[model samples]
Target chain A: MSAVLRVQDLSVAFHTRGGVVRALDRVGFSLGAGETMALVGESGSGKSVTAYAIMGLLEAAGRVTGGQAWLGETDLLAADLSRIRGRRVAMIFQNPRAALNPIRAVGAQIADVLRRHGGASRFNAGARAIEALRAVGIPDPARRAKAYPFELSGGMCQRVMIAIAVAANPELLIADEPTTGLDVTTQAVVMDLIQAMAARTGMATILITHDLALAAERAQRIAVMHAGHVVEEADTATLLAQPRHPYTARLIAATPTAAGSLDDLQSVPGGLPDLRRDDTPPCRYAARCERRLASCDGALSVRALAPGHQVACTNPLEAAA
Target chain B: MRAILLRLVGAIPTLFGVVLVTFLLTRVLPGDTATYFAGPTASPESIAQIRTSLGLDRPLPEQFWRYLVDLGHGDLGMSLTTGQPVKTELVNRLPASAELTLCGLLLAIGIAVPLGVLAAVRQGSLIDHACRVVATAGVSLPVFFTGLLLVYVFYFLLGWSPAPLGRLDAFASAPKQHTGFYLVDTLWAGDFETFRAAAAQIILPAGTLALFALAPIARITRASMLAVLGSEFIRTARASGLSGPTVVLTYALRNALLPVVTVLGMVFSFLLGANVLVEKVFAWPGIGSYAIEALIASDYAPVQGFVLTMAVLYVLLNLAIDLVNRAIDPRARRGA
Candidate 1:
């Protein structure tokens, strides 16, 4: 099946008082219709930036220097933000409470999207909002519809955010750290709700998160980003079982689940290079890589290791093959 | 509704405190009503007689008790300067002050809110810079100087304004008092000529007060709008694909209005206090000038009455603001 969304060579830079910081560089990924992909990374690894760029919701200082984000037939990067956003695509933000309009009723917020994009009539929007809330497993959704964001708990707020996101039933959904602040149980429930909805609607989803375990558990394919670059992309089980790039192997090693004991958890050596410098290397992880080779220089490009598996490093770990 | 009623009931003690403090503070001034009314050259015996007749010779507690009794009976006491009942003088003067203040407030909100929202939406643009300059100049200039400058320009230089001397021209007869507001009263009387005269006379003072009121309203609006626009919900609103205007006006502006409403209430009260200078400059017969005149003459009853009136007005204004705030912000309603 043709991919529902395909983002290619995306580069984003933030202009600040100090200098220009490249927030995202040459990030590329694709998700087929009804497929689930997780963009997993550490903080400041451009996972969230990539999502925002595709949604056309970057801050004033951040600009997309080069990119082509194709959502079906429309180029999301070039489309009018109003034309694509909330209609063809939607986003569920990290902090659900902060992501909602505090003063407005949560139901009204959902109804707003329905009316704005779903073409729901004003008279029936209220009922449809309650229906949306119910679909998210919110108890007493009719009564809860009248409640504002402040009145709800954190988990409930996330559910409301989910409800609002799926109200219009867009073709693609970008969930950026949707479960970061939620408890484990609530996180599972929220993720389950999203998965169920995506399954029912056949919508493609890009789950942006730093939780490697959660990504490995939920995603069909995983894209590991580091220092503003996607270093590895492969099937979730294959990537975790046989991580190709040294960075990906280190990430899997650092993750608590894959380690045999607490002592076995190995932190990645060194740090991500500062993107503000003019002499920054093309492969940001090169300086931190223990398996670096002399040829790991100049512009790095993605090379296929196996079908549906790619690594951006010249000296990727080839032990499994 | 219950919250509003509770707030109103709570205002009683606050008004009483104001009355007690004002009464004591006026008594502590260097001169008493007796000496001022008796004149500087009056005989000692005549001064004593005036003091006794005016009930100033009574003990402080007895005076306070009698004042409260008279207040309960709706008698604000007799003004020593004008020989009229304080309530009657206030009734005659309050509408002018209200008209001027209301006009100033409406004009300020009209100009400031839109300008503030525009500045915030187009932050760092030329319009934002211009708004900043306007806000700075408004807060920097004293109200009297601004009033005088306006009068000089509009009346003296441009010859576009009427004489800045009270609510109407001296030669024109006053309109019959129905509502006591000259603008409304003239319009009620179907005398467009008197309405035109009243409108022309009020322009400079109201304009001056509007400038004073605009700064805080605009600044608060801009700051609040900037904050609300930067919030995560604004991104949510934008991501929802609501049109830009809908997001700015419905989502951003509505949320921004809470602080703006608060500042508007404060600015209204501040303008009432600031009205003294504006009234004096234009020779308008408003309560601010009346209070000042009574203050200069050490006329105890009118001064006390003016303070009491102001205190009551403030309490009521606060209640109104609380209601408006509750209407706009669900959180405020829940907290209350």
Candidate 2:
């Protein structure tokens, strides 16, 4: 499959009262048309930053220092994204209730997005909005659309959020911890709905979350992020069978699975390195990697073990594992 | 409608409290109402007769009972100074104060809301600094001082405005009293000349009140807008690819206005209190100055009636605010 979205050498920094914090450094990834890629990372791993930077939704304090994010032929980082943001690329945020406007009706909110990007007229936007709500499996879309976000349950709000994100049938949907605040069952349902929508529209998805099990179950490719770097990327099965990067292995070890007991889970050791420091190492995860070598201190780069699998570490777990 | 009815019913006790307090406070004043009504050189027998005739010689408790009974019958008693019923006195002067207060509030909103929104949108910029200076100047300057300064500049120095006199000049006849507001009444009577004179006479005082009212409205709007702009939904709005204006105005401003509506209610109450000084400076025949004059003369009825009227107007204003809030925010409706 051809690449529908490509991000290369993306860097982001936030100016704060204390100092400048470099959040992302040279992070890069690509998604094919209709592909589902999961960006799995711990807190402060810059997964959401990458998504926001690509969407041009970063806060005023944050700046994209270096990067190129290409959506098809257009360079998203350099291009005027106002026209393309909701038309070609859309986002679903965490805490669906907060993501939706509190004062507006759910249907009117959807109609706002549709009218802005979908060429829906004022006369038909209401009906089309209800139709969009119905498409996301919201029961009684006509009545529920008139309801406000506070009136809906968490799961129902997530469905409304999905309805809004896909209102224009954008080519790329970025789901940033979309199911974070939802219940476990609702999480599964929401993820399934997102998958179904992506499949129906042939839309690519980049799911940003730290839940490795959900990523494994829903995504075709998994990219493991450490600190601010994309430390590993591979097909889900291959990555799980043999996680070449030590950080990826530890992340998998940490995740709770259906078959794994509480004792079977092994937590990833050490916290993320402080990116605010001036003398930080080139390899952000080297401090925590048990396999760290002297060579890890040198310039770090991604080396492919197979056609689809890449790892950034100097030392890797044996393939025989 | 039911909510409004409930709210009105709930306001009864508050109104009663205000009436009781006003009655007790007026009773504590140094001079007696009957004594004030009777001339100073009047014979002692006539003063005593006047006290008895006016029911002031009765025991305090019986007097309060009679007062409450009279209030129940919507009889506010008679104004000692005007020798007219306090109800009629209030009815006659209320529209003038109402007109001035409403005009001031409208002007303040027209200028302050947009300035606040602009300051919040370009926060820390030159326009924001300018807004801060304007708000600071507005608040720091006293209302009467601003009123006098405007009179000095517009009326005395420039001759651009009519004298800082009452609502209409001596030359202009009173417009046919449709609404009691000179501007409205003049228009209703198709009396454009009197309307122009009324508008000119009002501009300085109204502008003074507007300047004082603008500070709080602008500050609250800017603060509320800043908070709403930072919320997650605002980012969602931007990510939706709506135009910048729509995102700021429709999404952010709508949410921001909830706090502003609340502040507007508070500012309206403050402006009502601020009106007495403004009315005195302009010589406008409004109920505020009427209350002050009655208080000085120890005319118990008009003072008590003025406080009661103000309390009732405040209650009605709060009800209007609640309705407006319900319209703007569905969550408020749910809470109601």
Candidate 3:
């Protein structure tokens, strides 16, 4: 299947008084129509940065040094920000309460996006906004539409945000830790809503998260990132069964699941390398790898281990024959 | 709506406290109005008669009681200096002060709000630097000095402004007092020439006051806009495919305006206080100058009346601000 969205060699840096922090380095991934790809990593691992960079929503200090994010025929990075942001691609932020405009009514906020990008007529925008809200499983959507963000619960606010992100039914949706601060029960519901929406619309989705088990459960494909580099990418089952990169193995071992008890989990040692350093290594996880080889110091590249399975390391684990 | 009512009811005690304080403070001042009116050279017998007639011979409690009764009846008593009723003086002069204050406020808001938004949008750029310089200069200079400097430049150096005198040219006849505001009164009289003269005369004092008012308005706008611009909602707005202008004005500015409106209310009260110096410099016949004159002459009634009026105005102004704030921010309306 052709990619609905293809991001290739995306590199970003933040310029600050201390130094230029290399945020993302040659990060590349692609998602086919209606496919859900989870980009999993620890906090500050450039997962959110990659999402923001793709949506052209990076903060003032951040700059896309080199990249091409193609959504259909248009390169999103080079495209006019307004053209592709909501019409073609939409984002669901982590903190819905903060992301939703505080002073505006939730209904008005949804209607704004619908009118602007969904081609909803001004006269019918309110009805369409309520319809969008109801689509996200919000009960009494008409009454709730008149409420402000502060007036709603966290879960409801997130639902409003989801309604806004999916209002235009864009071809691609990027959810940046959409369930980060929510309770477990609400997390399940929100995730279910996103999955259901993506399936219903046949829209591509890039779900960025730190939960390995969640990625395994919800995403069709998984990409493991460590210190701004995609360490491994494969089908979710293949990545979970036999993670080639050492970091990916550690992550899988660390994630506690219904089948695996807490005692079975093993935490990875060492912290992420500071990206601000002048001599930052190409293989960011080489220092933490137990199977480190002297050749790991050289330029690392994504080597295909099998069809549709790639790992970026000089010495990747070989599958047992 | 209930919150507004509560605030209004709550202001009763605050106004009472102001009344008590102003009454006590003016009475305790070094010179007594009776003695000042009697003159330093008057004989003791004549002084005693003057004091008796002015009711200074009455007990302090009884005097205060009578003062309260008169105040309740809307009689602010007679000004010992001007011999006019203090209430009448305030009524006539209040419009002048309101006109100047309103004009200055309009100028300040018109210039500062846009300038602040631009400064915040292009933070760290040359325009931001320029705004910073302007705000700093506005805050650094005293109002009197700024007024004088403006007079020296526009009136003396450039010859663009009217003379630094009262509301109209010295020889111009006073227009019929309909609204008591010269601008309104002249327009009411259908005398465009007098209106032009009044408008020109106000430009210098109002402009001077506007500079004083501009600094805080601009700074608050910049800081508030900067904060809102950095908020997640602004990102959401931008991500929603809004054009740059819509994102700034509709989303950022609307949210930013809450805090700026709060500061604007405070600035309005501050400008009213600052008007004393501006009035003195420009020789504009406003309540501020009247209060200062009464203050210097130790006229008890006008000073008391002026303070009471200002206190009431402050309470009313705060109420207006609360209403405006609630109108703009529904969260505030809901007390959320």
Candidate 4:
């Protein structure tokens, strides 16, 4: 399958009160047709930055330093903000409440999206919007269409947002922490909804979240990010069965999986390296890695541990992986 | 609906309480109403007769009863100064004030809301800054000064003085005074020339008062809009990829309107009382200035009646704002 979306050598930085903060360092990944890829990382690890970079939702301050997010033929990273947002790319945010307009009826919001993307005419958009709402499993969608964002529960609002996102049915979907704040059951249902929708639509999806377990369950491939760099990428099964990179191992060990016993769990030590000082270039996970070696000083190169599995580390974990 | 009814029920005590205070305060002024009207040298027997007839000699409770009874009967006492029926003057005076207040409110809303929206949308830009400056000017300057400035420019320089006062020249010149409001009366008369002059006359004074009021309304609107724009739900609206205008109108303005509506209600009520200065400066016979004339003569009848009417109107205007707010936002109607 030709890559439905490709983000090559992407870097993003912000000029905050503190000198330049490298939010997203040279990172790269791709999602093939109907493929689900996860970019998992802790807060401030540039997980959202990467997702935003792909969605072109970066705020006025953050800038894409070097990137070419090729969505088939169109380079998303280089496209105008409005064009990328309203046409080819779509996103689902973490906070469903913050992702919708409080005043408008949910149906109106869906119709607006449909109209903007030319998915439906102004007159036809209303019916299409109701259809989209129904597609996302909202019951009595026609009646609910008149309800404002505040009238709907968080879960319903999230579904309404999904309806609007799927209205355009763009080739790519970036779900950044889309289920983070949701209750576990709600999270499962929302994720299942997205995955089910993606299966039916054959659209590529980039799920940016901190939950390794969730990524493992939802995504075909998982990309572990640490300090704004892609540390490891592999099929979910292979990566889970045999993880490479100390960061990836630490991540897998830290996740408290319900299916596994507590003894299998371990916590990552220290924290992400500060991305400021001129001396800030290195394996960001080096200080946190128990398997760190003296040679882990300069550029960490991508070494394939298995076919189609690339881990950026000086010494790739030779066990299981 | 019950909450609103409850609120309306609460407003009664408040209205009565405010009216009672105004009634007592007007009586408490150093000079006596009897003396002001009767002249200081009147005979003792005559004074007693006047007091008795005016119901002033009655005990405080008895007087309050009489006042309430008379009020219920739509009978404010006859004015000792004019000797004309108090209700007649009140009936005549109220329409002019009502017209001016109505026009001023329309003017304020028309200018304030759009400018406020512009400021919020273009925050930190020149338009926002400029609107801020204008708002500050509107709020700080006294209505009298604003009215005077307008009169000077429109009357002397630009030649747009408001229609002459008390005369309702347009209405009198037109065939009849069937509808008390000169504009309405004039328009009803089917004499376009008089109607045009009557409207033009109102414009200068009304605009001046509106300018004085515009700042606060604009500031409240802009601040509320800015706050709404940054809210989590607004971000959600954007994420849905609803185009910019829809996002702003649907998400931002609806939430912002509630507070702005509250401010507009208060401003409308305040303007009812404050238009006195504008009326005086423009030599327009609005209730504000008419009340001052009643104040000078110590005409207890019109004063009491006007105060009661105004208090009632203030509550009603606030209620109107609430209804409008509820109409615009159902979530608010649900108290969410």
Chain A TM-scores in order:
0.98, 0.98, 0.98, 0.96
Leading candidate by TM-score: 2
Best by DockQ: 2
List TM-scores of chain B, every candidate: 0.95, 0.97, 0.96, 0.90
Docking category of candidate 2 = high
Q: Give per-residue CA lDDT, model 4, range B1-336, as digits (tens).
A: 787798799898897797678778777776666666668789877877878877788887788777878877878777777777777877777777888888888899898888899899988889898888989898888888887777778777876564335424444463377867778887787877877777777888788878878888999989999898877666655655666887788668878988998888889877986777777877776567767788888887777777877888888888888789888877777773
Model 3 ranges with Cα > 4 A deviation: B170-178, B185-191
Tens digits of per-residue lDDT, candidate 2, B24-95, equal: 999998987777788888888999999999898999889999999999999999988888999998999999
- Which scores greater on DockQ, model 1 or model 4? 1
lDDT of candidate 2 over A1-321, digit per residue (tens): 579999888999999887888999998889999999999999999999999999999988999999888999999987899998888999999999998999999999999999998899999999999999999999999999899999999899989988988988899999999999899999999999999999999999999999999899999999999888999999999999999999998998899888879899899989998888887899999888898899989999988999889988888888964
Q: How much is the TM-score of the A chain of model 2?
A: 0.98
Off by over 4 Å in 4: A81-87, A276-278, A291-297, A300-307, A319-321, B1-7, B160-191
True lDDT of residue A204, candidate 2: 98
Candidates sorted on DockQ, descending: 2, 1, 3, 4
Inter-residue clash pairs, candidate 3: none
Candidate 4 lDDT score relative to the true structure: 0.80
Look at candidate 4 and tell me the lDDT of residue A87.
54
- Our tally of clashes for model 1 stands at 0
Which lDDT values do the candidates have, in the order given? 0.91, 0.92, 0.91, 0.80
Clashing residue pairs found in predicted model 1:
none
The better-scoring model by DockQ among 3 and 4 is 3
In candidate 2 chain B, where is summed lDDT lowest over 10 consecutive residues?
Answer: B32-41
